[model samples]
Target chain A: MFNKIYAFIKRDVTIATSYKLSFFLRFFGMFFSILVFYFIDKLFGSTATPYLMDYGGDYFSFVLIGIAFTSFLWAGLKSFSKVIRRGQMMGTLEAMLITPTRISTIILFSSIWSFIATSVTALLYLAIGGLFFGVDLGSANILSTAIVLVLTIIAFSSFGILSASFIMIYKEGDPINWLFSSSSTLLGGVFFPIEVMPDWLQSISKILPITYSLDAMRLAILKGYAPAALTHDILPLIGFSAIVMPLAIVSFYLAVNKAKMNGSLTHY
Target chain B: MVNTVEYSIETKGLVKSYPQPRNFFEFFRGTEKKPVTALDHVDLKIKKGEFFGVLGPNGAGKTTLTKILCTLVLPSEGEVRVNGYDVVKNGGGVRTSIGLVSSDERSFYWKISGRENLVFFAVLNNHSWSRAKERAAEVLEIVGLESAADRRFETYSSGMKQKMAFAKGLLNDPQTLFLDEPTRSLDPNAAKEIRHFLSSLSKQGKTIFLTTHNLAEAEQLCKRVAVLHRGRVQGVGSKRDLGRMLTRGERLMLVVSGLEKPGISRLETLSVVDSVGVEGLGGGRVRLTLELAEGSVSTVLSEALKLGLQIHSTRTEEASLEQIFEKLTTEEV
Candidate 1:
């Protein structure tokens, strides 16, 4: 299993490196976006916002962490569906499906390289924030941050698999991707804290796993909260992973079975 | 030999159907469509270490059967077992025991090298990285792609891409190999090479179940062949048996220049001739096709000579596999 995963990563890395310009362009694109955010942070003049004061005193650091975490969230939430779409387009999906590996194993391993790429982007975000934007991570709790990151990835990837199931069956017009992407971006506290929303809207935000993930990450990275003190955010993320991962797996299995019964597994 | 051989693949009354759209507005009305049968009660048994062929025209369910045997598609209403394991209950087992090659050239990642693609698939078959690399090299060499192993698959010509697909199928060293039109896109030379390679693999005791529209290919590689038409197996046997099923006698074509009416009547009186067809060719020449019962070619020829019919050419022909396939598929059962 490890060897299969390693092979998938190696293949993706080789392909990624082949397009030298695009590979370097992505980093440059992310770097310039951070610089844009840095100027916006200056416009806010270091005034402590009510929503961010508890997590961090500066908008720059708060939004930087949010951007970094959301990058991971995007990778986790889109990787599986993206791979499925590519497989279908390239006509490799049936070839992969006919292998001895389980469907879940294929989905999981195919997304590993995307997650690794996002992790590097996340690190670059932190580096740019610290070196030029005056963001501080000296007080960060590395162990607790790692735990939050893992749990968050698990929860987000569950939804990714669900989106991939839709792709496998529908071939186009996946409602899950649109619904999840819009809702999470609007309500998951990626830009400002959810407290700024109306009371009823905040209730909607509370139900999203990304909300808890971003909150936990902020508490660990900015507030330096210990694992015990981070229970409020960690518990929901873990609970989401535990419940949704199985559901995603079952949904994907059923989708595959439906395709098989319809004799459309290899059809685009 | 087939009767006593162990079976590697068996399907009992297998059926598969796909839902068909009712009308253009059916999607908006949320109405269900009727189902169209792709395979109706297909029962097949392939012996271990035997090279088997399924010959059919387009939309004849050859590909559907191959997909079901490879565990990529489900049989709607029957049991399918590959290598003693049920396809549904033990798909992983079946998958591990079988390798598949289809005509689709886009199955490999276009951006990756041919070696990378093979190694990745080998690893997916549960080989360690080192072993996968070794096996990938071995199969690449076997398929004659070792020199171009490091080139991106997208850069390969269509024939080279097909060879790479063959290499990928051999990566697992599977017990049984399923090939669906494996030489469909190849030029004659490449196609012949693949045929030779597959024949060698059969000699090594690997069970090969091939589906193809090329009758000559089937005739060359398969010891036994099944003809499928309209989602049903028309006939299943060796070339001789299938030919015998279609005709109990022989067909002979005689090109001759006729002299008189009595000669035709005299030739028709021979005891061996079942039926005769005469078509006028211009310039006082005629083509006579004689359908005779078995062991009647010599008698018919002698009778024609005794009739004093000036023979331009005499050719003895038997029922070919192509003729048998055409007769069986075109005629209603």
Candidate 2:
């Protein structure tokens, strides 16, 4: 399993680096996003701090963690299906499927590189924010942050697996991907606190795991809260995982069989 | 179920059908669409170490049968067993026991080296890292691609790509190897190389199930073949067996000289001769065409000589696979 994962990551890394400009542009794009937010932080000044007091009372720091962690959210949500979509277009998905490997394993191995790149970029966000932009890292509770990140990824990955199920069958334009993903960016507190939303919108936000994910992440990383104090956020993330993971698995299985029956496993 | 000891693949009343693809407007209108049958009530059994071919024209369900046996697709009805394991029930077992060499050339990661792609697939087969590399090298050597193994797949010519696909299929040393148009788009020299490799595999006691529309390729490579047309198995047997089944007898042309109508009448009346026709060459000689019952050529000729006919020339015609395929697939349902 480790070999498969390593081989796939290596395979992707080679392909990704082969396009020299695109390879460098990913990091360039990462910092470009940070620059825009930094300027936005300067413009807002201290106006947003009142709502951000729970996360160190600094807009830049709060927004930095929000964007950095949601990088993981997007990775967990989009990585599997994106790779699958590319595979379908390139005909590599059928090549992998004909092997003895399980579909779940193939899904994991195919996209492990995306998560790794996300992790690297997320750490760069932290390092850049801490060194140049004055974001706090000294008070971070690493264990609580790890637990929240793991559960957050699991919750978000359920939606990804569901999205992949659609790609496996339809080959493109997976409906729920656009739905949950856009919903995450809009309501999951990646840019602003969900607490600022109107009460009805906040109610809708509560159902998305990312809302809990970012809330728990800020408390643990900025305020250094331990797991016990983070349970309120952790519980909902767990709840989302329990509900959606099984559904995603079942949907993926059905989608695969449907494609098999249609004789379109290799069709795009 | 295949006995597993004597047979490598067996299918009983196998059928597969796919739903017609709907357009955007049709999907919204909720139009009821018909399913297109790809394979219809096909039955076959292939012995262990036997080379079997499926001869078909395009859209003839040859690839569908290959996918079903590879467990890449499931049959809508009936049973298929490969290497003693039911394809739908124990697909993992069947997958582990068989290799598939597909004609689709884009199946590899084009940006990666051929070696890397093979190593990746070998690992998927559950080999250790060291073993995977070793197997990759071994198969690369087998396909005579060792020199090009380190080059990117996109750099390969068509022949090299086909050979790379063939090498990947041999990684696990599967008991039964399925080749779907393995030489589909290759040049003659490349096709001959693939055929030679396949012949060597067959000589080594590996069962091969090949699908192709190339009649001569099948005749050269397979010992027994099944003819698939319009989603049905029109005939299944050796070339001779299919010929006998379709024509129902042997065809013989003979040149003989005898004083006319009475001899033709007597020959037609003989039990071995199904029908007889004589045409005079205007020089006291006639061309006698005879359709003899299966295995009755000797009997008919022996009886002809006893009747005091001076035979000048004789020729026997056995139907070619192409002719038999044409007759089987093109005849009205």
Candidate 3:
């Protein structure tokens, strides 16, 4: 299974490399998104500057960390969309489905390549922001931030696979990508604090778990919160992962079985 | 069920169906729809080390049966077993025991070389990387693709792609092989090469189940052939056995120059002769069509000689597999 994963990852990475312009455009596209957020922060003036002052971190640094973490989280979710949509366009999804390996393993392996690609792009954005944009590394909770980043990615990817199962069964025209993009940008606390949401929306935000992910990541980067400081939200993230991961796997299996029953598993 | 000691594949009343939408709304409602039966109670047993060919026109359930036996698709009703393992209950084991090669060679990653594709599929079947590479080399050599194995499949000729598909089918050295139109798109030379290679492979211990519309290919390669038409098996047996099933068995068509008359009564009255007719021929030569008992060609010849008529040329013709297939399929629907 590890070998299968390795083979798939290597092949996909090579495939990504073959399309160099697309890779560079993806990197630049996410880079400009951060630039837009940076300008918005600048437009907010002292209102945003004071909040970072209270947190004892630079405002630019805070937004950079937020964007980086959110990028990886969204990257994890987008991995499934990439596999489903691009794979369908390339006529490879059915071929990949016919393999005897479990779908979860293949999805995981296929998505790992995208995760690595997105992470590298995120790292490049960070480096460029830190070097040329005067973005500081703010606090020294690097280890905690890394741990939270990994956990949040796993949680988001579980949901992504769940969404991908729906795509496998019924193609909704990339609605999951649209849903993830808009919701995470607006409600996931990517550019703003979740506390600013109204009570009802805040309650919904609390249930989302990505809000907590961004909060924990924000605290770790700005306030130098210990890894245990995020422990309060860990249970909820674990709960979401626990419930959604198995549901995603089961849904994937059911979808594949349906395809097989219909003899569409081999259909291009 | 096939006896474990003698058979490699068996299907008992196997049936498969796909639900057809009743109307447009049912597509979204996911309600039950009328099902289209692909295979209807197909019962077959293939012995170990036997090369069995399935001959059918398009949409005749050959692919559906192959998919069921390969464990890619489950039967809606009945049971199928491969290598003594129930296809439904022991699907993984059945998958491991058999190798399937479909017409869709494009399923493999086209950018990768043929050798890499083989190694990838090999690793999926649990072979080590070194073993995969070694076995890929062996299969490439076997399929006569060693010279071009390192080239991308996207750059290959259709025949080369087919040869590579065959190589992948043999990568795991599977005990049972299922090939669906393995030479469908090949040129004559490549098709003949694959046929000979498959024949030699079956000469080894592997059992092969193949589907093809090419009757001559089946006749040349298969020890036993099953004729499928309209989603049903019309007949299943060896070439001679299927030939005997037709009403006009052991037919001997001749164009004799020595016939004095177009409808010769002496030729009609020959012993073992079922019917004799002189079909039209130019320049006074008569084309004779003779029907005889399945094994009585020699008696018809001697009876013609006893008439004291000089025999210019005589040729005994048995029903070709092509003719038998046409007769079986073109029967009353």
Q: Find the candidate with the highest TM-score and give its number.
A: 2
- TM-score of each model, in listed order: 0.92, 0.94, 0.88
Model 3, B194-298: lDDT tens digits are 888888898897999999888888998899988887667888889887877774468786665556652378767666677776776776666677877777877
lDDT of 1 by residue, B45-102 (tens): 8999999999988898998899988888888888888888789889999999999988
lDDT scores in order: 0.87, 0.89, 0.76
Clash count, one per candidate: 0, 0, 0
Best-to-worst ranking by DockQ: 1, 2, 3
- For DockQ, the strongest prediction is 1
| DockQ of every candidate structure | 0.79, 0.71, 0.43
* Model with the higher lDDT, candidate 2 or 3: 2
Q: Return the TM-score for candidate 3, rounded to 2 decimals.
A: 0.88
Model 1 stretches astray by more than 4 angstroms: A45-48, B1-5, B21-24, B254-274, B280-287, B295-315
lDDT of 2 by residue, B161-181 (tens): 999998888888999999988
